[model samples]
Target chain A: MKITFPHMGNLYIAIEALLSELKFDLIIPPPSSKRTLTLGTKYSPETICLPLKLGVGNFLEGIELGADTGLMVGGRGPCRLGYYAALQQEILYDLGKEIEFIVLDHPKEDFVRFKSQIIPLIKAGGVKALAKGLALAWEKLVAVEKLERTAHYVRPREARPKAATQVLNRALQKLRHTNTVGGIRKLCRQECDHLRDLIDRNAQEPLKVGVVGEIYTILEPFANLDLEERLGYLGVEVLRTVSLVQWLKNNLILSSLGLYSNRWLRINARGYLHASVGGHGLESVARTVALAGQGYDGIIHILPFTCMPEIVAQCILPNVSVDYQIPVLSLVVDEHTGETGFQTRLEAFVDLLSRRGQGGLQHDSACISWS
Target chain B: MTAPVYLGVDVGSVSTNLVLLDAHSLEVADKVYVRTQGQPIRTLQRAMAKIARKNQWQIVGVGTTGSARQLAGVILGADVVKNEITAHAVAALHVEKGVQTIIEIGGQDSKMIILRDGVVSDFAMNTVCAAGTGSFLDQQAARLGIPIQDFGRIALRSRHPVRIAGRCTVFAESDMIHKQQLGHSLADILAGLCDAMVRNYLTNVGKGKEIRPKIVFQGGVAANQGMRRAFEAALNAEVIVPRHFDVMGAIGAALLASETICREGATRFHGFEITESVYQNHSWECQDCSNQCEIVDIVKDGRIIASWGSRCGKTDSSSEYGMLGAGN
Candidate 1:
């Protein structure tokens, strides 16, 4: 069976490593573009968030490429993500496209159902191949995260515009092609060094801003309009509050073991939010508070327009901003977001942060007023 | 002898404003305001020509702001090009030394900038909707058969104003008609519209923002006394409207240009002769990638001066035309 899945930044890299080792025929959908969004939107409910629409787009493209079975993850939470697979299945069926979906839910939630689903995949590849695939995928995920972190650090300090981005892109391309774990490790180090070399050591210290928000918007560049790259170009060092590797470690490994995941996040979020509002809502508040204490210049909270958890978090962020004395800009984005307006807000926010960092107004107070 | 002055241009969606500030004293020497009328180039050129005929001063520095800042900057060879938020905040601070909040409602956007100790602390602009901006108010005034200029004065005559929904323009329009059918006076209906708009702005653009005393209201909409009064009534605080409210964005741009020129030691002002030059803007879809970015070119005489709007930054007027033996 030809299998396919949705894309989420570098998650596809690790997924590819795992699937290829399983010896399953896979059709990786084309990288997301305007066409993908168009197809996705045409079939999706207008009020649904951007990620699901993009997910639908990915599935359609994969189906066109002869993918009959779709792979997706299911969750039990207040977030709508838990129902995404079912809804997508309905959409595809309504369009007269017959496709099977293998949704991997948490084993802890329903061990019997989870085992029934996972056993076949494991049997297809054998236990030894499954172990090897898991190890390779883990290695690739770690390598990818490290490379991305290095890219973020070097982006703002780079001497030339878009230099760090180019190096990161090249390295990611190579990482995709290189299959061996050792090769991935070696390539990551070399590319990271290359990114560092592009930095201008003599440049002024760049402003630091933490990005905290919904997981899908935070990780996907297209969903957030390349927020990190744009901020990097504006000379602000972006500190991503979420990473796929860290998330997996926290949610999958830690939570499945009946241990507390993101203990620090839970502790920090105590005063602001007592219980999980689900889908990274508590994490968003906790990260903002932590980043503020870390002396970050500002915080940018981004979410899809109809995102419920992030919307709840957005409402509480102002109090956090006021109490912590750190400025927070909440950006709600959708398909209709204009690039010019987005760019203007980012530029203005960066200007505000830099000016605040300078400790006063950039202009002389002695200037004459027209009024 | 002519004195050196800095020029600022704000090319907004509805109007274009130009301000000339004295170089040394930094005082406003001249200003011009004109409707953009969907043609920023022609509007800016006409404004520049008017300023050129009125003043004999030398423009030493130039800056541009507003929605079309980049286009205006390229046309004027501006020394500084900045966004409307920074420009508005700067101008508001200059007007009120201890200004804490700036309520700026322009042609198609509304903004709330919060300042703490002369530094902008937080700000928010209207997103995805222009429900209660200047254009909406202008349309309402036109539909009511009232000249937009007298909308504020007419609103002031109301004793009891009816409530109108301000969530959406379509809803607000129908609500106004409903209020009118219920035998409400024109003045009261206008006042109610203003209040509803103020409520919408507060909930949307000014959401979660600290609206402290020393609130400075400036922008094209500030000219409407009804909006100013509505804001005052809602906040229960005195709203200060600056003398040159309509052109504050332009004034701020000029001030920024002056600052840049003082530090950088030179100006990029292309001089007033650009008023006589014929410029044409052209846009075409680049099929080099799936992105299919529409690249725009600003052609001055026969030479392309600037090109933008490509995602990859590869498509340029020079390279595309040079291959066809067209570029200089």
Candidate 2:
């Protein structure tokens, strides 16, 4: 079967590999653009969320390019994403695209059930093949998570980022070409050594900034204007709350175990001073408090154009900034964003943090809003 | 001795738009729109060449917006690359001069901008659905075997409108087909579709809070008269479609470039010759830690200008001037 998947940030590479390993020809959606949005908007219902709309466009584009099967992520929660696969199937059927849908639901309650559900999709159905696919997927996720965590530590330090980057790229290249678990482990260890050495030596300090926001934009750099690296190059250390590891822990470990308190508890300890379901509200406030407690310079919250969860967080962020006596900048990106205006704000914010002595503790209760 | 001009291009999935404006007056000199058809570079190049041929315009400042803004910005040598909300609001402010509450919908997406004074106070975007958008109308017209161009005119003639399940596109489609199969008049069905589009738009895109007047409707879909009438009925007020309704995004982008050009005397816009250049991309894997970063390189004519795609600085390191390029 010609299997296809939507472009959700940087999921294409790993997904392509996994599907190809299973002997299925992978059809990737065209890059997400206005055309994808147009296709998605043309066929999808108006009430679905933006992410789903984007996903629809991706799938539709893939079908138009001759895809026969759709691989989708299914979830279980208050967040509407849990039921998106089913929702998208109905939407696509209405659009007149006949395709088999494989929804990978949360393995929280039953791995056996989840495995059984997916067993039919595999041509060579057995525990051995399942084990291989699961192991490869886990390896990919672990590889990506380790890199993201190491990035946060090394982003601010490396004097010439290109040097550290060269080492990382070489390692990733080797990993992508390898198939065995032992090969992945060997490659990872070698890369880790190089990255650790780069961090320990030839590192500089400008400012350390923690980033907290929605899951997609936080982990997916393309959606956020490469904000983390941009800050890193501006000599800022980036501490991101969302990573592949954290996502795995949430969906696979904590969520399945019903241990959801870590998120809320972490936020409360950070003094978010509010409760929010999603859109990184509690996380943003908590990250700010955590950064403040650690004496970091500032926090930048990145959100989508029309996200309800982020808007709630954006509204409450002012209080957190005031209470913690830290400078907070919220950047909301849509289809239309000015390059110059955005750059100017970044420069100004960095300058303000650099002059933390401008008001110091006396600047307590001051709210900073920049456009 | 002559003032410079800035070219701004706003390319969306539904339409491709271009605008040319004077550096000093910020007056819009020219504006045009065309269906995007998935190839932004071709669409933009065609738009630029058209504007240039018409006015004999000099190459100056350039700005890009919409989803392909970055690609356009890099290809066209844009001095400024911005998002659609900022570009739209900037353009709206220019036209209305402190107008508040702008309702902008295109073929694929719709947005509600609540402007307080001249600044954008609150805004929401419809990235998820098709109910309140142009695509919904397009689908209905196709099902009714009527050209979309004439779909709106017939809608305006309807005395009684049917009910469409505007909650979702699938439900809405089935409802429309059932209405047709039941021998409902074309006019009523058309009107029903319009009402559904309007209702879905307001509930989904315009979901919360007060929707004040000074409502401006613009976009490719804004050309639909039925949609306009539906909005009027839904809001219980008149809906204003600007003179340049279809090309507002381009106009806004042009206005932004004009502002920038006024501040900076000369423009850095690379001439139209950049069209034929072959843009190439190659990927490599970074072996740094457990995270093997996949690095992508952007090359034009075998000369690499930029590279990115790793979570960290794995391949494309940060370039000077805050612009990212191949690992320095």
Candidate 3:
């Protein structure tokens, strides 16, 4: 059976490894492009968030490439994300396209169904093979993230801007062609070191900005307009609050084991937000608070436009900003987000952060007022 | 020839503004505002032509800001390129004493800037909605068979501004027509429109912010006295209009350029002679795949100087002046 899934920044690498190792034919959706966004917007609900539209767009592109079985992640929550698969199915059916869906939900409640759905795909190899395949896939995941982490650290510090980017891209291209797990790990290490070596230790300590926001927008570069890279290029080091590994640890490993709550996020967000308002609002609030206390030069909060949880979180962020005395710039991204305006605000925010880091208040804090 | 000057250019969809500031005094040496009329390059050229004829000052620094900032920055080799928000905030901070808030309305957009201690603290720009912008007023003025210049004076003559929906453009237009059909006075309808625009601005763009004292209103729409009165009545505060209200973005760009040059001690300011050169735009469908992406080429002096609009960055030669290409 041919399988396909939505793209969420390097997610395809892990999934592709798993499915291909399981001996199932797979179709990887092309990297998201403007065409994908346009198609998604054309078919999606006017008020639906951006990631959903982009996800639907990915599914369609996958279908065009002859992938019949669609895989999606589901959750029991107030977020509209859980309904994305059903809605997308309905949309595709309305357009006379057919693709079967398998939503791997919280494995706790639907373990039997999950086993039944996956057992057939892995029928070519038994449980032993399945376990091995997963192990290798997990390794690939770690390798990809490790290289990314190294790139992030070195990109802004490199004397030659864009040097780390070139290395990372080339290394990724190498990683994609490698077949064995050991090969992938070796390549990842070599690439990571190669990227690290590009950093100029003598370069100035660049301003560090914390990027915290909705999960999908944070992971998906298109949604945030490559915010991390842009910040890196602007001589700013970006420490993102979310990543696939962190998401898995928080949602899958920790939560499933009943030891999942983020201590710092919870403790910091105590007076601000009490419960999960759904769709990463709790996480966003907690993370922003944590970043503020940790002395990040600034915080960039990215939320897809009209996201319910983010909208709720946005209302409370300013209070956090005022209380912590840290500048927080919240950007709401949609299909029509003007890149020029977005870049302008970012540049200005960077300028503000740079100036503020140098102690903007010179009157000895005696005359600072919001008025 | 005069002392060295810093040139700032703001190229928006509706207008192109150029401001030349004296290097020493930091005072406006020359300023020109002209209709963009959909041709950003031509508008920039025209604006520069006017500035060129008026002065022979050596340009020490150059900056560009606005929607078409990249295009203008490319054409002019701006030392710094910023967005309208920062530009507006900088200009307001420079001109207005202890400025705390900035309310800017342009052709199709409006933004609110909140500043504390001469630094921009928070800001909001109208996103894809033109209900509370200058173009809407222009449309209403044409529909009402009244000159836009007299719109504010007529609104002041009204005894009351009939309540109108200030939500979306479609709703506002229909609501205005409905009020008109009900035999409401033209002045009352116009006044209601102004009030509706202000209400729209406050609710959408100015939501959740403290609209404090020392508020400065600028941009193309600031000339509408009716809109000014509506703001005063709504917030119960005075709104100051700067002398260079509409050209604040240009002025801010100049200020930013000046600051950059002062710190960096270098510039990429192309001379004013570029104003005389003609530039052409070209586009063609790239038959690469099913997407058939349209590649746009900005030609200068018969050279395919820059091309973009492709998903894959092929046929895109990152020219020396990266600012000129449609890099998006």
Candidate 3 deviant stretches above 4 angstroms: A262-264, A361-371, B1-3, B265-267, B281-299, B302-328
Put down candidate 2 lDDT per residue, B166-192, tens digits, no spaces.
Answer: 889889889988998999998998889
Over all chains combined, what TM-score does candidate 3 have?
Answer: 0.92
Tell me the tens digit of each residue's lDDT in model 3 across A77-150: 88899888888888888878878887777766567776777767678677777887787778888888888878
Docking class of 1: acceptable
Those runs of model 1 whose alpha carbons end farther than 4 Å from true positions after fitting are A362-371, B276-294, B302-304, B310-328
DockQ of 1: 0.34
The residue-level lDDT of candidate 3 at B35 comes to: 88
Model 3 lDDT per residue over B209-307, tens place = 888999999998998899999999999999999988989999998988887787678788768777877799898988865445567787878887666
Task: Show the lowest summed lDDT stretch of 10 residues, model 1 chain B.
Answer: B319-328
Looking at model 3, residue B121 earns an lDDT score of: 78
Question: Which lDDT tens digits does candidate 1 get at residues A66-155?
Answer: 999999988788999998999999999999989999999987887887898898789889999898888888988898889889988987
Per-residue error (Å), model 1, residue B150: 1.5
Candidate 2 at A277: error in angstroms? 8.3
**Model 2: runs farther than 4 Å from truth?**
A1-371, B1-3, B263-265, B275-302, B305-328
- Displacement of residue A123 (Cα, Å) in model 3 is 2.4
Q: Which candidate's TM-score is highest?
A: 1
lDDT of 3: 0.81
Scored by TM against the true chain B, the candidates give 0.94, 0.89, 0.91
TM-score per candidate, chains pooled: 0.94, 0.57, 0.92
Better structure of 1 and 2 per TM-score:
1
* Fraction of native Cα contacts reproduced by each candidate: 0.29, 0.05, 0.16
